[model samples]
Target: MRQIKIDYRRPNPVPQPAPRPAPAPNQGRPPVRGGGTEHPGKTRRCNRHPGVHMVLAGYNTEWNTVRYLCPMCHAMGLPPVEVATGVINAYFPEKGYGFIENGGPRIFFHLSDLATRFTPQLGMPVTCRVEANDKGLIGREVTPR
Candidate 1:
């Protein structure tokens, strides 16, 4: 007999992010450029498509793989922060895969129709724009919205 050791959950689909509700009339505020506080009388951005916003939520670490991880910096407890703010990474019109190059490291992103223009170029100039509503960084944009 033989046995295989591998991540059992890898085969399953990545969990989707919580959805954002559409803003009601006079129930929303202006969109913020970078991270900021939500004004008392402000709503989020105008999401043509609201609900079920998913992000490439993963992190990296310098911990030793061979050794057991310490309580600190293990799992989602220490979610990695980005090094750069807004930067484009990749784009594919056909496959529909684009990425925003945050400061810390590269991050994977899924763009809709408008983002298809900014395909992932190896070394092209891309403005990695991160879309944030009431929620943190829900969606990413290679180009401006």
Candidate 2:
């Protein structure tokens, strides 16, 4: 013979507060006009340096983003030259050696010379800043296109 006891108790339902009435429309203040129309309360600023009013130096169509020269970044008298474009002819990731097709003698580059956020790939279109030395043109700041 076996005796078993079963206990059954229903759980209580949670109480919910009554729904709030809808707020009256037009409670917010009207926007004041001073800055550009694109952003009502916001003003145009340097993309690199916040709080710096950007000056219209030029348009960069390739990047599709406006270029801004901050006083702290472009304090030098001379502006940087345009970046040169070429296909990466070869790249040895293990050895950190690479070449670009710049229509001149084989342009040599090292992994350290590439942009910090960029990784060079063989046959990838890239833009670089070049400097000439006795050996040949050395590519620096290599970035993919």
Candidate 3:
């Protein structure tokens, strides 16, 4: 003779929140007035820096919510170069280097471009950004769409 028993004390899992809508042509905020270094309700600042001004409103693919891309970050307290004008002089594929004609020495780019559709042109008017990483500067998404 054989006997078998089953226990039923385990609790049901919690339901996660609903995800946001995506696959949008342009789903973000319009440009605000007086876009500069100072964000809303911030005491610390520097007048010299005019932090990065991004036109696109980003949604965190991870959290699935719309979050603004700060030109710099909160740690700096000072603003970033929100508005920048320059050109991509060369793209050295062999050396994994890129140069900006008018931008400074730190001005370089590495293309792990997630936005695969974005094809950059050399010596073209590039109104984009360089995000801060461990290596220092990394170019981000482009604008004027």
The top-ranked prediction according to lDDT is 2
Write one digit per residue (lDDT tens) for candidate 3, span 1-145: 6443323221221212344455365534432233222231222222233454433344333322223444455355643423233467777767655754433434466565323455556765553444555665455543221
Clashes of each: 13, 0, 4
TM-score of 1: 0.28
Q: Which ten residues in a row have the lowest lDDT in candidate 3?
A: 7-16
TM-scores of the candidates are: 0.28, 0.44, 0.36
Q: Please, what are the lDDT tens digits per residue for candidate 1 over residues 7-53? A: 21212122234444665666444433222111122223213324322
- Tell how far residue 21 is off in model 3, in angstroms: 45
Candidate 2, residues 1-145, lDDT tens digits: the string is 6444322221221212344465457444343333211122333454356777644454344422223345655775534322345679998988988998744456788988877676778777665656667887788777675
Q: Top model by TM-score, which number?
A: 2
Question: Candidate 1 or 3, higher TM-score?
Answer: 3
- Runs off by more than 4 Å, candidate 1: 1-87, 113-118, 129-139
- Inter-residue clash pairs, candidate 2: none
lDDT, model 3: 0.41
Ranking by TM-score: 2, 3, 1
Worst 10 residues of 2 by lDDT: 7-16
With candidate 3 superimposed using the best TM-score fit, by how many Å does residue 115's alpha carbon deviate from the native? Answer: 4.8
